[model samples]
Target chain A: MYRYDEFDERFVRERVAQFRDQVNRRLSGALTEEEFRPLRLQNGLYLQLHAYMLRIAIPYGVLSSQQLCQLAVIADKYDRGYGHFTTRTNLQFNWPKLKDAPDILDLLADVQMHCIQTSGNDIRNVTADQFAGVAGDEIEDPRPVAELIRQWSSLHPEFSFLPRKFKIAVIASQADRAVMKSHDVGIRIVRNKAGESGYEIFAGGGLGRTPMVGKRVREFLPKGQLLAYLEALLRVYNLEGRRDNKFKARIKILVHEIGIDAFRDRVEAEFARADAFSDDENAELARISAQFEVRNYEKLSARSETFEAARKSDPAFAEWVAHSLFAHKVDGYAAVTISLKPVGGVPGDMTSDQMRFFADLTDRFSLGELRVTHAQNLVLPNVKQDDLHALWRELGKAGLATPNVGLVTDIISCPGLDYCALATARSIPIAQAISNRFADKARQDEIGPLQIKISGCINACGHHHVGHIGILGLEKRGQESYQITLGGDPTENMAIGELLGPGLAAGDVPAAIERIVGVYLDKRADGETFIETVKRLGVSEFKAAFLAGAQNEAA
Target chain B: MKLLDRNGFRTDDFSRAGADGAARLDAVIVPFADLPSTAARAGKRLGVDIPNTVTVEQLAPHFEKLALIGIAFPASTDGRGFSLGRRLRRAGFKGLLRASGPLIPDQFPYALACGFDEIELPDASAARQPESQWLQALGAITLPYQRGYARPSSIFEQRRQARKEAAHG
Candidate 1:
């Protein structure tokens, strides 16, 4: 909800001007495609399979109603009237021309938004918890820190040309909502014994060809020294990280190659060395924190009588109530997660009408704000519990109420061979088939808290490696084969899932998942979730049944 | 090679050292491998050309004798030189810093901000992106958000000043 000031506005305007010039240069043969690739990518413009996809950065996943409306306008004007929300908390338009890019950037800057650092080898758009200020488990709001980082990393002269893409995530909660351990740098806000706020830093975690859980670099770094420490860490990585192989260029490889302790030593030595540019210590931090927009939450009874009555009266609403609501720190408010996955719809795809509808609802049902989740859903961060039924009714009319947040059918998928030039096969269609297979509401509720993540390739944009039921699509022997991995977790105790034997045919994937779920249902103890059962009985127990059924389906 | 400072085109001041060594009274640019020989002669102003990978710690010993450092960027995108330049400056290298590569006009600002006094481009790159384009690129953004070599106050400090003025007024 923080609005851009004159300086920020001027900054974005100048960036748009700069990008426009770059585009002109590329058009006139002043810059080659090879030369202009990184430049265009930094502006969030990617040439996809058939067309140019324009990605817009919603910094830290927070967007104002006005900004959301503007996105709808752009989607209608430039794109094919729809936008896909990416797992990185970005929105992408699959069909945009190169000429229209600068105008689109100008439109984004009008709403205090720009696509800078959304892609490319530079430090990417910073991400944080979707339920930052409203979550019950929060220690401190991470938005201020996320914004400060965004400002500091924006056009960083020393770090703009990193060996590979760098991602940073911030969270201030016991519940890891931002996939904290899976980023290049993960910062968790904490208070020490003396009651001073600090950070617990994680370094070098990523999922690409090789998946890894980031090691904790600093147990407790003083909050004020975060930027300086990050600068030191990046300087060491810039100087020492491998550039020989493109696939192995991520900071995770460096941390894995040289042990975390050695990496930490180099970072600490650099940190203690002569400070080149001491980051805007606490002065800029205070300013951002003050501008983080405190909500004037209305005081009311803890239980909303209307919400209670609606839950008892309407089964459809009750079914949605079970999974959609997250506990808010404020007594009378609840964070409502609006699922972009509706039955068998394209996961994370939102029509222009849906965008406009959601923007309107943000003003009426909640405050004039919303947050995009890493799971490709949207969260109304601070909705009054009293307006539960009204919000649900509005959502139902727009096909936004799916009643599946963490359920079996709620999947994370990437636009694969259909759009991405890097993909081996299609991911969206597979996600659709699985969602339709598990469409039975009763079955979905029975298999609760199951994450089915699918990535078309090993880039893992869909985050299959961290998924509870990971499906990786690989092209084997000129055929699309899906490899299944089990027992992966994305929390503090993060683990990479293990492979479940050989890859399955495309048609056998849904049947294989069904058999695996059947195995879980049979083996689970009382009230055990899918991941819990997998953890308890080991993934091997379900393997025999899954492989047996998958073989039968393929034959 | 084209040598460019913030103002415009510039001529090379230091002549490249030969295999024998540098002239005692002349400004000489010696290769990294030939530094030991050149430094012993104690020229009027000694400069070394080294790859970006060389650490500031490795170069710190020669700070007193060295007057210039030309960092080799094998590719424009290999940003190790920028970080190395900053590290050298922070480690008390007061001599001139030069970024040598085929970098575009777009990268000129980053080079300057990272403590490079000038950039030396290969002949082909200089022909492709002439001095006019590079000079225009310098003024692309009159003011940027972050602080660099010579800039006193960033937008952050500017904001603080505005806030102070608001409070006092």
Candidate 2:
């Protein structure tokens, strides 16, 4: 909801110009592909399997209707009339030409967006909880701090070439919707005994070839010193992180190699050495926080007559409300999650027309803003309860009203071997098969609150390491094989999933998942979710079911 | 090798110290490992060329005796030198700080903002990215977002001053 100031505008424009010049230099053979690769990657241009992909950052997952419309326009004009929203809450146009990337960046700059630091070994797009301001349990809005960080880290002189990519996530609520603990640096807003706001800082949490939850470094860092502390932490990691092996270069690996206490002591020493915090930083924080102030809300009754009538009249409407609606901090408002995962559809993919439709609905129903959730869905953070029925109706007309927010059908998947150059197997088709197997809405509801994440490779872009039912696709011999992991959690109690026995063949994946779900159904107690059932029944039973399924397919 | 400053191409006044260890009156640059032996032979304007891995604490005690500190980048992508430059300045190194390696024009602004006085590029890098590119890249963004550095005044302070003026006027 924050508008770009003159400085921000000029900064993006200059970046675009610089990238354009780089592109020209590449075209003229003044720079080799190896020389140009990192430059383009820092600007979020990737040479994918078939073509170039341009990923644009939706800073902190927040987007205005105007910006959404512009994205739709860019998709139609430059891409193949579609864009895929990533698990990082960014969007990828998979078919942009290298020549057209600068033009696309120019278009994004017009909408206060750019793809800077979206990829590369730099401090990347800072993420926060999608429901920051409107969440019922929020201590403070995390967006202001996220934005301040975005500004400070953008094209940072001392940190542009880190040994590995750095991700920072901020969360204000205890729910941990942003998966804060799995980031390189996680900041949780808290109040001390004196009721003054501060931060609980965690460092070195990530998911990839190696998965480790971040360790708490500072118990209570004053809010004013956020940037200073982050600078100190990054300076330590930048100079000291391993660089000999690319796979072992993440800050999490550094923290693991040398214990968290040593890492914290180094960071603290660096913090004491540098004069990072100053009056100018406080003023900057104030300037940023002023932009995130809550807008005027009308004092409407908490209970809406139209909403109640619609719920009574329509069973489908009630079902959607049950699954999609989230409680808002405000009495008369609610946050509405529009599922991007429809049955048998590719996860996180949206056509240009669907994007335009959502933009229009955003203007009409919610405030003029919506947010992209890390779960690969869109959220209207300020939908009025009075407008819920009408909103549901409009969403249904556009095929956006799928009541599967946390259901089995709401899968998070990556663009595997089909698009990504590094993937060994296809992830989208596998996600589709599983979603179709559980397409029955009643069955999905019966299963209840399952998170199925599928990643095609070990890079873990799809976050298979944290899913309740995690599926990692690997190439065994030549054919595609899928490995299942159970009971992984991404919440405040973050834990990596363990491998459930051996891998299964591609055809047996859906049936294996079915058997796993069947086992859960048989073993679950009253109102127990999939995760709880897995925890109760243990992985041995699910492993037996999966092995049986795999054997049956083999026979 | 080529020397570049904010105004573009510049002449290099410093020469590398020879193995003979003879006294020189003008500026002479010596490797950090050779500093102990070269200190006696060098003149008042002594320069120490350090590897990127060398920390500020290692260089602090010798700061008063040197006129320049050159941080070696090895490769353009190895950004440890940038952080090293900033750390040296933050630790109150008022002497000249030079980033030496094969870096690009795109990195010129970062080099300057991180408190480097000049960039010493290998001949190949200088040939690929000429002086004009470096000069243009220096002015790529006239302002920056950081504070408490030795660079130009931040946009944050500028915006605050503007707000204050508006309020008073």
Candidate 3:
């Protein structure tokens, strides 16, 4: 993880002071609520349904043990002793006082963190793969580049107030974990024919009211020209993106309207003209790269006898290893996933005590660092193979050792109508119900890698658009209606899921999901995943099964 | 509307010119739509106030003809004007460039850095966020991380200089 230098520290301190003044002005009647709204939103404070919610940016989803400790302290002191980690890999304190926001920001700054650009139309926190450096199939670690972008886009003079919120996600691995194709700009670090690592830039990809898989504007952009290329793309979007309707203001809509060919031409022209990058930027990248480089790993055997013995002794530990462990680039090291989804718990909510315990575990087992996944889980990116059993035991003590990483029970949900002012229906209860229904580990394992994502509203904050099984909750005629979409893949083959027939009542969602799963299990071959089964059987079979279940449930 | 620059409040030296050339103030701000019909006045400081919709190419040719260019930000959240300002500067507009809108004081540094020599705030906005607040807001962030803007020194440049000094020292 990159530590904040003096410049970065001073920058955050000033920003906190600036926001403090703004909050004061807002309270003093010097600034109207309308005037103060964007100011507060820029600093990640939102006026939610019952109270103000403060979102803290976990930059690139990476956190040090010390930072985690600070987050726990803040949660205990300012919030209701818990913070909900969002799908963006950021954390939201649901009940922070409006006046205490400045204090919270000051606390975040102490840990080299701040909530700047977490919300609003500004270029939001640039997210990268949680397994960036540690992943087995990575082309290169994207954290250094992600950090450079974070600096470049932070309080950007020319682009602070874009037509709409823009999100950029970078993924270096061939296997997409960061939902790259569904961001405003998705950068896939790729190698050219010459075997030099470069970026494949995808623009106009976003998922909100209008879901779009990004269109590739540039096939291969030199790694050196990353900032310049990004600036050119943003400049085109900033100048040309529609401001007529708020819903149609995203770069996706602009790209969709003008076509990618014309958009590419304009961007290429702008790139030719704009002197966006300098030698200083290259130097900064070098400094950032040095920070991400880990040179302290000891070479060890790939197989660990202790790990084998632990697995033989405990079946639960063995299951956890199969479900939660990811292949590490280094020998004897595995990336361990600490699942936040215990059965019937809120998808991403972690209590203050859990934060402290998780931090202590990270300090002991995983090089004192952890990464928050977009799927609402924490990842210990460098756990030794021998320590897996010990870590599992520690995690089990805190109910963190859930052997359902990509299974149906491991759901991604939003703070819907219960907290979010924008939400029309409840999502947490729906998530809880589904999790309880699929509490059986064997059943979830049988379901096999089904992503059940729920959103309280059409904003898709829960990323319902990309889930294998997306459930969007909408309020229709004062009744909560849940709409199901099948085969919504967020991987390299990204597509918005198709709507399967009419909406179901909120109470009937789990039954509908069960029928869908039942259909999948019935039709699936020996090794077919839920998505693979859906693809093979088509949406029509699932729809037939769903309708049949709905009729039976109504009876 | 109060016209403000790096200096406090300044008198408006420009005005809008009509097609007939009968309605001309000291320095005229010709609207983009009216530019084709309105003949350019020699010795008169001609300026164009462009909407966010206008492209840089549409206004590039007039860079030499205009003494000042005003970018209209209809709303504070609509940031097209910021890009427009940078484009105008890149297009070699040597004269005064102004951001005219109901912008907040928080945007003072952005406006200056984006090549805006002055800000023309609506009377109500000016009354709400006075010159003192704007001045205070300008220094809120001591250094910006960006390059190629109106700022004297960006943080990137400063850091590079410091690094060089440390090597020598």
Lowest lDDT 10-residue stretch of candidate 2 chain B:
B17-26
Docking class of 3: medium
lDDT of 2 by residue, A1-555 (tens): 788899989989998998999898888776667778889999999999999999999889999999999999999999999999999999999999999999999999989999999999899999999898888898988898899999888888889989989999999977898999999999999999999888999999999889889899999997678888888999998899998999999999999999999999999999987665556566777788888776776787888888889999999999999999888888899999999998999999999999999999889877788999999999999888999998999988988899999999999999999899989899999999999999998899889999999999999999999999899999999989899998899899898988986788777788888888999999999988889888777789888887887777778
Candidate 2 per-residue lDDT, tens place, B56-162, comes to 88889888888899999987788888888888888889989999998888888888888999999898878887777788877777777776556777766578788
What TM-score should be assigned to candidate 1? 0.97
Tens digits of per-residue lDDT for model 3, A91-120: 999999988999999999888999999999
RMSD per candidate (Å) reads 1.8, 1.7, 1.9
Query: Per-residue alpha-carbon lDDT of model 1 for A57-131, expressed as tens digits?
Result: 988999989999999999999999999999999999999999999999999998899999898999998999999
lDDT of each: 0.88, 0.89, 0.88
Clashing pairs in 3: B14-B27, B15-B27, B15-B28
Q: Score the docking of each candidate (DockQ).
A: 0.63, 0.64, 0.77
What TM-score would every model get versus the actual structure? 0.97, 0.97, 0.97
Clashes of each: 0, 0, 3
Candidate 1 clash figure, as a count: 0
Return the clash pairs for model 1, or none: none
